[model samples]
Target: MTSIYYIQVEDRNSMDGNRSNTLAGLKNNFAGEKEVLVFSNHATEITEKYAQSGVKTTIYQNDAYTIANFDAVLTKLKQIFRSKTDYLLVFDNDSLGSSLGSRIAALLDITFVADAKKITETPNLTVTQDIGATSAKRVIPLAKQAVITFSCNGVAANEPAKVDVSSWSLNEQTKQQYRQAKTAGNGLAFAKVVLAGGKGLGSQQQFKPLMKLAQKLNASVGATKAVTDLGWLSPERMIGISNLTVKPDVYYAFGISGAVQHTSGMNKSKQVIAVNTDPEAPIFKLANYGIVGDANKVISQLNDLL
Candidate 1:
């Protein structure tokens, strides 16, 4: 029987519900054909969710919190692979999955796809990826055994559920190690709305209107690399590449050109609206609705609409 391994990240807060999305996608895609295995930190709440989604097997690790300890998790994965040559879908909790995915594939001597969005099986296994600035789609043919780092957008279709109780034990030493390494940070992923700015906003002074609009909506502020690079905004506010991935209920892009790197981080938003002067700006292509005009003017009108 073909098997599917869902690499569940222990740091759910950091992933911004990405784990849930990935698991849901797997369940929807595989359905009755394959067995689903969820590897997580054994958080009772999260584990129960996966189990309810029809995940037949669940593996819990004690020290799965930090990026430094991912190798230990990989070791256990190797053991699972030894028994069955399964197609492993490595769902990133953050960008950390990108670093560890290839290593896991190398260890198993299987081809690995980075940031893959879709997987299909015909006579051969086929994978699709969104790469480069154009969000170009590429396909790769794979043999039976392969590892894939799935994109969050591709897996957002699955809905998380509250599962019946099924517990697993972990080693005491690993549990102690994880507890000592836990870190604290903001929960930006759970934000209801995000007001993001870009270089097209003109100057640092222009950011005030965006901030004002964000405040009116009670949304957190986000920025593109251009604004951050110019030092007009802090790097922490940047939302692409090395920055945080967001999936807020609503994402407002002001003067952003919609570079692929920037779009990749927030494409999972429930609704995307872009305000830009350039009618052909790349960001407008992905937006659900767009207004081609001065951001300042649009913002002022938006304030009135709100």
Candidate 2:
């Protein structure tokens, strides 16, 4: 029996971000027995696209947090795995499992593999997960009954998953739980001010001032693709052509070399302020205010003032 590859799409509200290339990397890599289960309140054209791809797609009429009920998605997975030919494959995506999937893996006690960069077929399957932003990786082998989570860092393919759609409604009990658990959120979309950092921030330690600055102004933190790719920041914060497209009232770019791909995401900002040592960085062209200096030093001084 062939092992099943399941891609879980948890939130549909933010689906516009990557609906085109959603899970394309994993689908292209797995290449066999794919199922995309979306737990969302809204339906989009991609559902039909999945059907065209000849994959199995399921949608639940609820958000991901509610779908994570012990008697819900986890129970459904339990039912699927009863056949011994099926398993779960979720990218630790911001849209999907970053947390919900891990909880399910822990609940099921499945041989959960995290951060798998690539999976290879060598008589038996081997999973390679990256440990560092630059090079190091850890390889894991597939098990008969395993639950895997991947980091959606690779470039996803344009082809949508091939699948038919199946819809499920949320239970009343879960609805109450969701209502009680939900809290106030003023996420990046709502942030009037955004203090964005790029790979030029240097290291994880250097990112401290950026965060401190953000807190001072109550601004949200954004990043470039390179920063997210290097594991210094979450893919959720990535501001780029393929990631987040932010239009805050004020957007500040620090240490950002201003790649076109990165700048495009923030070009819509009401006021752009770019800080870079190089006077000729492409980011400066778009900046209403440009400060040509060492980012670390400038940020340090700004933090002191704040």
Candidate 3:
């Protein structure tokens, strides 16, 4: 069987610098001559670097972005599997395309790996997931087919190379429930300042004051899993595993205990300021500035000052 590098590319119009590096690394690490297959839902086509790398490139682009879902992607994958030997499917951490790839693997009853920070494939494929203080490692013998999602920094997706190639086609169908809701704000992804509330926030009413403060600062508001799960805040505002990950200039956490799951998403912030009444809170350990004080009181003071 031949080894095929199947990548799900998002931001289809233009390739992200991070993903560009990832493609380079995969090509460099491949054992011998392998096919590079890229997939996208958008109408945008990639650059010509893929073919220039001396590898055969086949791009599967959806002619239109209508009624898209994981099942639609799955339908397409099944078609390609028949002709190809086996595939090493790769996706970016928490990406839409990656999510689809995972679902496709599940439906096909194939092995899948998520949030892999590091991957080395020599004698066998070893994937490492660094979850804060502890790390998990797994080795999978190169299989007939498998799915893997790559971490942003964990695997150094920012390689010093560019290989963007793409094209279009009319794709598949949607199986899941579909509703058109308002699009989520691109705050954590683009905000210079973010104010994140945690489980310490007693109620939804109490969260309003922090939201007001964020607005005054022209900042975006984020929340911990506990608060979001409690239905106190929107899931789009969540910052953690299986949610949106952010790296802002200044990250402000109020009433948050700084759990590893939450911190894993935001620890990359340029500066972190944590406010919790508990002096023993874990957030203080990673915060650039820590305050052992009531979160509401501090927000009030900051609000008055602003």
Candidate 4:
């Protein structure tokens, strides 16, 4: 039977909801034959979560934290290559796991699918690519085995496996190497309520009211790349391509025109509300509710209602 592997950032202790989505998608599609392997710097926390979810197999790196040290990962990959499993699924953040899957496939002389949005097996192996707006699906004949990296938003969460934790070991040299190079800039991913502004806000000065509204709601403030480029807000606060991907419970778009790149990141939000002066802004198409009027005015009125 084929096995699925959910690879995540090692040093980061928190369980990735995105990984959860990928695993969920695999479960929905592959069902019982899948197993999750969590690779992490702090193995205890992540492995415990995996065990709770019933994934019996776990791998830990003694010193592997960042992608720079691929030794431990390579070792783990070699083990997977030896396993009887015919298919391996890898998940990554952005392009972090880009070349890892390809290298493993070459080592094992198996078919490789990089940045795949969807995967299915039939007469041949099929992979889907999510290339902005259009979905590209292709079929590849697998000569030996296959390794694939799932794209963001491609797969939903799978039902967690049922099992107890099993032991695995990592090299001490690799552990020491990672400890020396570890840095603190690795940021946290939060589930926030975001208030985002865009070019329609007119001027940088016009963004203050929006900020105040966000502050009132204790929400994180966000902006489109245009607003950030204009010095209206910091790049850290920007949402969309060249910015952060947020899946907040409530996402408020104040004056954002909703470019596809922008929407691609936040489209997963549970609730989306847009306030724009133009009734025909593309954002309205995705928003659950929309107010077609001056963003500043509508925001002020909503504040009063609050």
Candidate 5:
């Protein structure tokens, strides 16, 4: 059986080489299989190198299918697998990987498993994955076809060999305009006031007050890596190393514990005010003004005052 591994070319460098490592692990797991296909958005030097390394490489690139254009990408992907009834599709369990893989699975009506930790083909092809925030494990049976996102730390370099790279393109439909959701813009980098939140906000619903506050204050909304990781906010709103770096004149942090990954992005802000329930939260040390209280209460009080 052949397994298709999808790699988002743009995130290859940002993810600390996890793509190559995961591909190596996949190759190892499906050893002696007919082939392990490398499907990517763009045929970059690195991906082309994979083609040179004995991997079956395929690229589907077009204006309508770029990384920023998920709808177009999704449409193109559905077209690719519309007729396939039995296959294995693999992706890294990272943000982009999981999002794209799961979306594709949903659109194609294919079985989906996320954050896979292990794969075995004994009595049946089953996947072992963590459940309930890593507190437990569950084994899923892959009876026929499935799409999976996996995380592994093992590294395996591809051996050099010759192979051909296959290219795929979208069949251009009638010209049309797409209306996308509001995205965090470069204004975040130049905003005079920024309202940022972190994991301490509790849930995605509880995070709404902070966004409402940003609207009332006419400030840009920012997010800690943890918040973005939880899908509470878009990745574009993330403030951290490798993400957006902001130096707003004033930064209001709600429930932020101030991990270095977050502080590095906004350390240049002229003034910092933080609200958190934990008096010992690290964000207070760097805050020019600190409020030791529930972030939701603080937001509510501020909203009421406004």
Candidate 6:
């Protein structure tokens, strides 16, 4: 299979070192000529790093290419990647990667799979996912061309001889214009500590104390999709299946019911402190420390002590 991995780099000065594993995972999982696509203004570091790590890399740097500008990104991708590969793979942990995979698959009119747990080739490409709370798994045979976003945790990283790098830039302007919104929780992905609230928190005003607590701890604030949809928090702060995924050093889940959608995003946190009114709340299953109490009252007491 001919595969391509798309990685977004927002910071010109730094790159996500963890993505090396994702790139290596792609190379290991599917046998083919795999390439890395670095989408950023400063792609040199990433292109060189991945290229030296044994994957052919291409850099796409355009001034107007922002996360909010989906049309521009899709157009550029169509120009470079459309009909050029057998499989398109992206990281499942981030909103950007997973979202792009689906959109691009639609644009190319190919098979699209999201959040795949495993993929194998017994001479034919097949994907598998565990059925909820069951021993059985769902296996699907993939089409000739497919786009898949999957987890990279268990995949082993490999180092091979460095390859050459290629670059592409847009000299012409795009017809569509976009204004990027300055939303809260942009730092949620890299936050060392996160304070996340769910619908169980009661009301929108309840988040004020959570935000205050986050400020005190120098942590980022996050909200479940239910909270964001109700306007209690910005959509960017949402952490769930179709939103941002984070692996913080410490995660504080406030009043969250611990649904699979929400837990999947933060299950990798080093330490989880969950607060909920229900003693049997599912969040307790994954929490290192569980407190069966009102989330707002706990926040108020913590604020006073801090």
Candidate 1, residues 1-306: lDDT per residue as tens digits? 345666655553233223444555556655335444444544664554454454554545443444345666567667768666545555553456666667778888888788777766665567787668686888888666777777532222223443433333332255323322121113455576788888988899988777645534546778898888999876777788777789998999988999999999899999999999989999987899998988888887765554
> What lDDT tens digits, residue by residue, belong to model 2 across residues 30-134?
755666665554446345535544456775544333433435666565555556544555644443355555766666666777666676765677788877786
Per-residue lDDT of candidate 5, residues 1-306 (tens digit) = 534544544322121112454566676676534244433444454454465334565555343333445565577667767886666777778666788888988988778998898888777778898887767889999856678898754334436544445565544464433333344443577677899989998999987777656644546788999989999977888998968889988999999999898999999899999999989989998899999999999999876554
Residues 82-200, model 6: lDDT tens digits: 75656655544456667777887888888887767677876777888668778888888888677777755422223454544444544446544333344435568788889999999
Task: Judge candidate 1 at residue 50 and give its lDDT.
Answer: 50
Clashes of 4: 13
Q: Per-residue CA lDDT of candidate 3, range 1-306, in tens? A: 336454544333222212444444555555545565655554233434344445555666654433344555566676766465566676666555467668867866777887766666666666666665665555545466777776532122222233444444444443333232323444356777889998787889998788656644646788999998999987877898768788999999999998899999899999999999999999999899999998999998886654
Every model: Cα RMSD to truth: 11.3, 13.7, 12.3, 10.9, 14.8, 11.6
- Where model 2 places Cα greater than 4 Å from the true spot, the runs are 10-22, 44-46, 52-54, 61-71, 85-88, 93-96, 132-134, 152-162, 172-284, 287-306
Candidate 4 per-residue lDDT, tens place, 1-306, comes to 445666654554222212444454555555435666656656564453454343445555443355445555667768855766566656553445666666767777777777676666654556666655665555544443667787533222222545333444554364433332121112212445778889988998887677545534545677888887889876666678666788888999998999988898789999999999889899999999999999988887765543
TM-score of each: 0.51, 0.52, 0.48, 0.52, 0.50, 0.53
What is the clash count for each candidate, in the order shown? 0, 6, 3, 13, 0, 0
Error of 5 at 227 (Å): 29
Candidate 6's C-alpha runs over 4 A off are 1-18, 132-135, 154-306
Task: Tell me model 5's lDDT, rounded to 2 decimals.
Answer: 0.69
232 Cα displacement, candidate 5 (Å): 33
Order the numbered candidates by TM-score, best leading: 6, 4, 2, 1, 5, 3
Candidate scoring better on TM-score of 1 and 3: 1
lDDT of 6 at 177: 37
Candidate 4, residue 144: Cα displacement in angstroms equals: 3.9
